[model samples]
Target: MSIREKIVKEYEFLKPEMIKTIGELITFPSVLDEEAVETPFGKNIDLCLDKALEKCKELGFKVFKDSKGYYGYAEIGTGEEMIAVLGHLDVVPAGDIAKWESDPFKMEQRDGKLYGRGTQDDKGPTVIALYAIKSIMNIGLKLNKRVRVIFGTDEENLWRCINRYMELEEKPSMGFTPDSKFPMIYAEKGLLQFNAIGKGESVVLSGGGAYNAVPDKFQYKSKDLKSLEEKLIANGTKYEIDGDTITVFGKSVHAAVGEEGINAIKMLMLALKETGVATPSLDFISDYVGNDPYAEKIFGVLEDEASGKLKFNLGKVEINSEKSLLGIDIRIPVTISKEEIVTKIKNIIKQYGFEYEERDFLRSLYVPLDHTLIKTLRKVYEEETEFDSTPLSSGGATYARSMENCVAFGAVFPDGKKTEHQPNENLAIRDMDRAFIIYAKAIYELAK
Candidate 1:
């Protein structure tokens, strides 16, 4: 059989083992922990990283782990040029365990889908890519360049894992990360996270899943719970009314694509304004920001052919007797400068007597469509899938932006449902099989 055919046959034979490996990785609650010193992120994350590297070693690949337990990589082949397959092992915390149909940490197969926290996001994709490399090796294909599978542990948080990895290792010649959509991505928008803080009255508000996910539930405390309930009923929102508190429910999705999910914090803020308990922070958000997913009021009609329009997500909100803080996440267009976006945001919030502080910023990534790496990956995708799709752009930030000559090539297909950062996140078994074939072919082509 041809090498390609051999790769496919091996992948089919090893599919069950691949599924089992991913399921095993999901059992660890590898969420970030600030108190842990030796592991930094947490013990579970450290354990997950160790297990991944151990698998690499078992497969006869050279594995390396940093002393700090931030990042690790497994490599094969021997050449000056290296192709990196970047993926993360860390997952976001499972918010509201009752929301899941099965245990988020325990992978359950039903209707040909694997239900778990890290199934679709990174862990599953990471394992599948590793197995692809193993399949290539099984075929005894000698590559012209080395292939490195880099595992990161802090992608769901601040990306310190990647940051530390870059500091210690040399940049790859060219590479693609399998953590995004298929047909490949050529550009990703800039990311900006900031807090708009201002003093408020007796109102106290707190809710959200994470900085990267839209808040699905929000709780508000005040003397006007009855009025808030009435407004919520009129608006047709899902909510719970206690004696002096109201809990509002909204759909959660990745902050990168905020338009896909409802922002519960936004709903609560609007309700507060309607009930006459509007603070300056609430007034600023309600009037200036409103419920629009795009920041049209702040920056009118921001868009470009590449990376689409600028998206916004009010991911979090915290209100107390001292000050009210609104955590805002913005995906700016690649062509826009940080100064332009930050200046406009600061100018608006400063007028409301609120202090603006930027927590993090990831610059935009744009590589020309005609580049060699983009063309090679796109050709491989079309050849494997028989779909003539063009390279795309995204608002989601990936490790692709952390290094030069890199883009996010997917484990996610174009027609697949997006469950990243959503409740009951899952990946289909059929999709995993297809992605492995594509990744194996791409890696062989790149390495050759």
Candidate 2:
């Protein structure tokens, strides 16, 4: 049989084992713990990293671990140039355990889907990449370059894992990360996280998780909510009134697509303003931001053709007797400068007595469509799926930005649903089976 045919047959035989292996990795609640300073990211992440490295070793690939417990890699083949396949073992926290159909740490198979936290994000894709490498070996494919699968431990928060990889490890000649959707992501937008700090003295309220996700729930405990119940219902906000506690409910999604989410923080702020219980922060959203996730009132739908519109996410909010602090996440277009975006924000918020404190920024990434890396991956993708499409751009950040000539390849297909950073996160079984074939063929093409 041809190498492609052999890969298909091998993956079919190994699909059952693949499901079992993914379950093992998901059992770890690998959320980042700031208190665990002795280890990188956290202890749970460390254990997860160790478990991934152990699996790589079991696959008979030469493995290496960072002395500082930051990153690990599994390699196969012998050559001067190396191709990196990036995946992260860490996942976002499962927001609201009640939202999940099962334990977010336990993988479940139903209706051709695997329900778990990291299934669609990186862990499942990581396993698919591993099996792809193994399948190529089983088919006796020749490699002109070494292929390395690098496992990162902190992708949900700061990318310290991949950042350290760049500092301490040998750079790959070219690579692809399976953290994004197919066919190919040639350009990604710049990311900015900052807090809009202003004065406030009112009822206390707070909500949200990371700077990169649209918070699903925001709770405010105050007798003022009783007066606001009618306004909240009139405004069409999803919420629950429990005695003195008012909880606003919204759909959680990645900040890159913040427009799709109903920000509970936004809903709560507006409701406060409507109920005559406005703070400086609530009035800010009510007057300036409103319900527009694109922040058209502030920036006039700031966008460019290369990376689309700037995405705005009110990731976190706090209102207390002292001050109002709002944590905001913005995905700026590839052609836009950080200063331009920040200046625009300052111009708007400063009038409301708020100062923008810069938190974290990831520079935008763009690779020309004609580049060989894009061409090779694009050719293989079209061949395998019989679907032809142009290279896509994204607001989402990936490891592709960490290296030269590297772009994010697929774990999610074009038609597949995105469950990353959300509760009951899942990956379709059939899509993963297709990814197995895609990664195997692409790896062989890139390395050979």
Candidate 3:
């Protein structure tokens, strides 16, 4: 049999193991908890890293875990040069338990799909990449470069996991992360996350979790919120009330595709505005940035052919008697300068008595379409899926930019299910099976 056929045969037998391993990872609820001193990410995240490395050892790959508990890696093949597969194990908080069909931490298989918190985001893909390497090992493929699969614990928030990896670990010659879609991502938008803080004493409000996910749930309480609740229903939103506390529901997707999901913070503010509520943050949002994901209302049209349009997302919001704050996530198109965008934002937001303070920034990434990393992955994608190998530009930040010559490969198909940050997050079984084959062959070609 050919190398591809042998790898496929080995993986077919490993499918059950693959499911178990991915599910085992999903059970960790490895959300970052900076307050936990047991490890850099959190107790659960550190334990999750330990479990993942244990799995690597069981798979017979030489494994190493960072003493600081920020990252880990499993390696095979042998050479001075190394090709790497980097993915994160950390997940965003499971916002509301009632919204989930099953426990978000426990993987559920039904209707040929596995549902869980981290299934489609990074963990599932990370495990698939691991098994792909396992399959390659079963066939004893000759390698000219060492193949390393690095696991990070902070892709959802700050990429401190990757930052620590670069500081201590060996850099790979070239690699791909299976954290994004198939066909391959050649360019990624720059990310700008910040808080817009100003003075206000109008109303009390707060909501949201991660800086990169659209806020899908918000909780607030009031003595008389009946009018606002009616407005919420009139707007066709899902909500719940008990006593004086109310929880408004919105759709959550990664901020890269921010427009696809609803921002719950915006929903509450819009309803509150109708009830004559006033706050510095709420008033600014109503006047300048209602519902439009591009922030075109304020920034005009920031678009480029390489990376599509700029995306604006209100991931968080808070207002009180003392102050008001807006936690914003912006994806700037690849061609746009971050400085230019920030300057315009400062000038405009200052008009509302708010100061923009940057929390994090990731410069855009681009690998030429003709580059070997892109071409080889494109060839493999077309050959395996029979899908067109059109290179894609992404707004989601991946670890591809962390290394010198790395690009995001696939775990999600071009027309596949995308439930990354939302409730009922899941990955189709068939899609993952296909991804297994693609990953094995891609690793073989890249390493050999």
Best by lDDT: 3
Sorted on TM-score, best first, the list reads: 1, 2, 3
Per-model TM-score, in order, reads 0.74, 0.72, 0.71
lDDT of prediction 1? 0.87
Off by over 4 Å in 3: 95-103, 194-303, 309-330, 336-357
> What are the runs in model 1 whose C-alpha is more than 4 Å off?
12-20, 23-29, 33-35, 92-119, 196-301, 312-327, 347-355, 414-427
Q: Any idea what lDDT model 3 has?
A: 0.88
lDDT to native, each model: 0.87, 0.87, 0.88
Segments of candidate 2 deviating more than 4 angstroms: 94-110, 195-303, 310-330, 339-356, 421-424
Candidate 3, residue 251: lDDT:
93
Clash totals for all candidate models: 0, 0, 0
* Candidate number with the higher TM-score (2 or 3): 2
* Clashing residue pairs in candidate 2 (N, C-alpha, C atoms within 3 angstroms): none
Give the least accurate 10-residue stretch of model 1, judged by summed lDDT.
200-209
Worst 10 residues of 3 by lDDT: 200-209
